[model samples]
Target: AAQTDAWDGVRALRADYRTATGERREVVLGDGTVLSLNTGSAVNVRFDASRRLVELLAGEILVISGHGAGSGVPLEVATREGRVRALGTRFAVRQQDEYSTVDVFESAVEIRPRDGSGAPLLLAAGRGAAFCRHASGAPHAVGAYADAWSRGQLIVDDVTLGDFLAELARYRPGVIDCAPAVARLRLSGVFPLADTQRILNMLPNSLPVQVRSRTRYWVSVEPAS
Candidate 1:
């Protein structure tokens, strides 16, 4: 039944996984690394005697390394920009069109730019950095509500309304446009990911914006009339 179907799904995604829009997925690698894929993400896993790697094809992922510091086989997550070698860590990687971002949560990681222009950065826990093919930016403290999506929550603390809408759009299938007039409005809350429409419905209650729905697949947040 459900469990059997779930296993079948896992087998199909072991080597390569591409989540449908609004869908999230989790996979366990042979070495016991746990990967949590965010909406619309794609990844491929490659493991050999000498190395274990996960290629992030699209979107974002949260990884918990299975191997310890003493383990001979190394675990790394690769994006188009470069590879993030996990130093026995828990971290998240987001592959954007122009650059890739990494947030170290538990231990540490080494960010190596694909072009190798500069020395690789050693990012410790509680820090994050963004890297392009040629360079990586200085590490910054992790955001207040970072990686909350992995736990089926979208926690916002004083983020702009536009930013919140952008994140909400990831878990939803349609376009959620926030008007410029309301884009800068401040928002802070813990919104559940299970029912995204409910989140939209409640937004007007807290903010001075109206949720205009042309269809379930299309929505607009406009300044209240």
Candidate 2:
């Protein structure tokens, strides 16, 4: 079953904020930083004299550095893999099971892996990087629509059905099985994420696939009969 509750216990006990499945929220920190929490996301905020830390316990978050009345303290977003220290920039950080990805939209950020073996890297604006506990990948160009989800939209460009569903699944509960038969079908659009079921129903209008639901919690996309 698909679920984002792995960090539920930690979130209940320590998280400063979180968003449920299919829900998006924005939070303002003490230092004037704005945090946009994506679906199924949880975070814990720790502000001290030395630094400001927003520990991502699960899912994704978009951070906009604030220039508020608070004192100047470095703001960082930490995942299980490593820490992303903001350089007076705007960025989004996503936490996955094996690695974490950072998309920098403005200014730059310093990525420091949890393990000491790999050297830290300075990623500039308009670039993205994926890093694990021990090493970081080379920065690559990223699309401007990286933060589209914050606006309750999913903008895909000629992506495979399987890939698209994999991302859509992040916003809902239960399994969204894309049968291999129809997985290769491509799609592109600006779909409203407010209603995922409506999005699923609209797929057949563009692709050669049919959506079947055994229950609200189980859905499969297969080749249209």
Candidate 2, residues 104-168, lDDT tens digits: the string is 99999999999947557999999999998888998999876789999999999988999999999
- 88 Cα displacement, candidate 1 (Å): 0.6
Candidate 1 error regions (>4 Å): 1-15, 68-71
* Model 2 pairs whose backbones collide: none
Score residue 75 of candidate 2 by CA lDDT.
88
Worst 10 residues of 1 by lDDT: 4-13
Q: Give candidate 2 misplaced runs (Cα > 4 Å).
A: 1-9, 12-14
lDDT of 1 at 141: 100
TM, every model: 0.90, 0.93
RMSD of each: 6.6, 2.7
Per-residue alpha-carbon lDDT of candidate 1 for residues 65-104, written as tens digits (9 for 90 to 100): 9854324787999987899999889999998867899999
